[model samples]
Target chain A: MKIARHLIAAAALAAAASPAFADASTEAFVEDNANEVLESLNDPSLSRDERTALFSRYMDEFADIEAVSRFVIGKYANRFTPEEFERFQAAFKKYALAVYENELDAYRGNEVIVEGSTDRTPRDSIVDTKIPRADGQEMSVRWRVLKRNDGYQVVDVALNVNGNLIWLAIEQQAQFLSLLDRTNGSVDALINRIERMTRDVVAGRR
Target chain B: MLCFGVTDRPPYVDIYLFIEVLALKAGQAAHICCLQHTEVIMKTVVSALIALTTLTACATTQDTTDTASGVSDPFEGFNRNVYAFNEAVDKAAIEPVARGYRAVVPEPARDGVHNVLTNIRQPVVFANSMLQGNAQASADTFGRFLINSTIGVAGIFDVASTLGVTEHNEDFGQTLGVWGVEPGPFLVLPLLGPSNFRDTFGIATDRALDPLTWTEFESDPDLDDHIAVGRTVLGLIDTRARLIEPIETLRSQPEPYIALRRNYSSQREAAIRNGETEADPYQDLPDFDVYDEESAEGTGAGDQ
Candidate 1:
């Protein structure tokens, strides 16, 4: 349910941004992306290693991480110079890839059926998808994606199964945003703090 | 029985099967005991079990906040194998795809696709800025960009940037921000970009009813359907291909998903509030002002 919403949101965000391709855009992108992705999925010759590599690319083409990053980074543009910003950009992309690569790797044969997109301004949409588990259990995962360009980015993923992970991300973002809102209306302090933590982790200080 | 569909994305599979077992067991016990409101309890449990199954797949770890409290970000425990998968694609898939599109499409057409996308987003952005009380002309500027994107250049170009049309990204999630909801963990969804729990919900609300179908789908997508779809999807692929190099930076941390969620979470808000720049609190900030160094040239591109 939650993951499904994420897919829907991605579609909605794409539709909202490119009103021109709203209804059928995903059908097109999916068919196109799936066509490319499914080729490898069908090749018995391919190993999971090969399949993972293949799907990752498909996912990249499917998602514009840099663009989405810029969209999400919205304001932090000013505090850093171009160089400093790029450093953060590097950090951001690495983190994004590290986070998502597994989920893509997890895509074996399970069909994630995308249902519909939502139509409301000022809100995110729910993308519906289903997971038919092997143990005679069927469930749903909705992807809550944000639309931008003619495509969408997954901003949050919800699992109707547990509802914990999706809720966890949202609840945390809200808390962090509040911190930013309260601190001179900027993310500087929080980012600064995170950077410090990151540095420590990288340096093995933490 | 919660007959589960076998799929590729899991950890969720194990969890879902487990819930199904729990529910079935509970139902059997309920039937034997003849508990009060058996049907209602069964439905509630079933619904919750079903709902819980979905929750486990939300691959995020934790949201950004002072570590005094908050769950650790899930990405902190990333599968290194997945990292390799991400890195490989950054090299193989996008390069060829980008090369293919660049060869076939005209630059103007490509830019037109880019522009049109930006234009439509201005209003949503304008609303975001207005909500934040961060900028003054946010709404009007958004409205102007909206018109230009929809009409000017036949809706081919995103005149917003040229005219300094800034967009803000406020949404139900940000509203929840106003209410101080926590952004759960950072999650990198397959096929979806990046997000967190709260924003995930925001994503759901954002797409509840697509306004585009009503507005854009009025006419037959028409005989040029394949061509039209190809052109646009290609335009989109071109856009995605463009980001591969930059997006790879997501792997720098153990918790890429959480990092991305934080960045995007903030980015969306900043866009909507039209974060005031030292140089232009009153004037709208240009799109991708800092990143697109090439476009940053005095194109003043922001002629408006």
Candidate 2:
């Protein structure tokens, strides 16, 4: 009876180990969104404003902006009131969208090929990709996807720029930390700074 | 030996005293008092202290024997001092220059320079690949050099990559590792960061084998010096600029020294394995999927 039970357990383990049973769904999710962003950038009919709006919408759909904002705020997260936090989150999303929109505009004839996904945590997966440039140079990118109640959302994008892994969230965290330091660690100061930046982005000042 | 001699001296002295008393009596006692009492006591105390210290040192050595054997850094004390010096140089000079370079040069221009530099080093890489008996990689590297030099406009653009010839960055150090040469003692060279004894030799060999080192420019000493200095400075700036973000991240880790050491060792090991080992399972994943925006948005809205 014990032997039979052991055999059953081994069979179940083998079934789970199969490639088809791995996290293909999550990998597909990240790749699909990445391709959409690339395709939207390539669309000729869309005006700059239209393209920016479409990219923002895509970011909102795929990215957990609130989570990223809270994470970047880091240790100072507890300083904000409920209303202040909400405002900060909204402003952060706009600022992030503007930054990404500008960055993506540089993509001319690059192709994003998703390599695979690795489960970093039970609810998080890091999807790897290679962006082949027109000149034959290749860049690596990793998308950090979080499994929410509804589905997967991208929380961070890490680009291997010149062999250096530059994670967006971590970079933002450092920026926020320095900004807070410069403002005497005041949440109001940070909020005002973010608000001003968001306004500048909306006005196309930067 | 001195301590033992001191401890045994009292018995010998007593016997000598007894013989003296019988032979010379009280008349010669004053003459024999030349041996100072204070000097004898001081010698005994110093010898005793020395013996105690020797015992303590022995115990300490025994306690550290296990750790000493497990670790490979025989020159750790010297290496750490060198590491500190390198860190200071990087913070003061190298990092600031790299930052200034990044701020001044546009990304596209910087990448072009980087490509040109890499293309120039193809001959060295090809030679190492040949040494390692990797004919396919050697052919690819040679092909890349030829194509980029002609069609790619002096390698300012990587036209060879578009033609399906990817880069293989083989070096003499990696070739030596592939040939079963053990990585000798870990060393922290001043301004060079982490390296090993084997790699130090490898660097020397590679430099000697580089075709550029034996060029006709050597006949014109001034031109040779100019070329050498220019290449070194450009290469240093390019590498330091590329490493800015990664080094910052490494510095933020809890134990930067241990982190860097482990990273360097593991990366070298992986290079030697040539992606054959399953040391990193993530390297074997399939190509990424591309999704449509409408369906993704619908699902996302439903989830929220």
The per-prediction CA RMSD against the true structure, in angstroms, equals 25.6, 25.0
Query: Whole-model lDDT, candidate 2?
Result: 0.58
Candidate 2: which stretches are off by over 4 Å? A1-206, B1-71, B275-304
Report the lDDT tens digits of candidate 2 across residue range B1-304: 0111112221211112221221121111111111112233235334433543454444322212112011244454455667788789999999999889988999889888777877877887889889999999999999999999999999888999898897887667778988999876565555556656565556555665667666656467677556555566676677667665556544533234443443354345555565343344333222112111212211110010
Candidate 1 segments whose C-alpha is farther than 4 A from its true place: A1-206, B1-95, B102-107, B126-138, B167-172, B216-238, B251-304
Instruction: Residues A98-197, candidate 1: write the lDDT tens digits.
Output: 3344333244345556655433222234455565533444455555445566665454444443222222233223333344444653445656644653
For the predicted complex of model 2, DockQ is 0.04
Residue range A1-206, candidate 2, lDDT tens digits:
99999999999987766543447778899778877887787788988778778888888888887767766765455666768777777777777777666555444346668887777455667788887643344556788887889999988776643233345564455446545645666777777776665564445422
For model 2, what is the error of residue B230's alpha carbon versus the real structure, in angstroms, after optimal superposition? 0.7
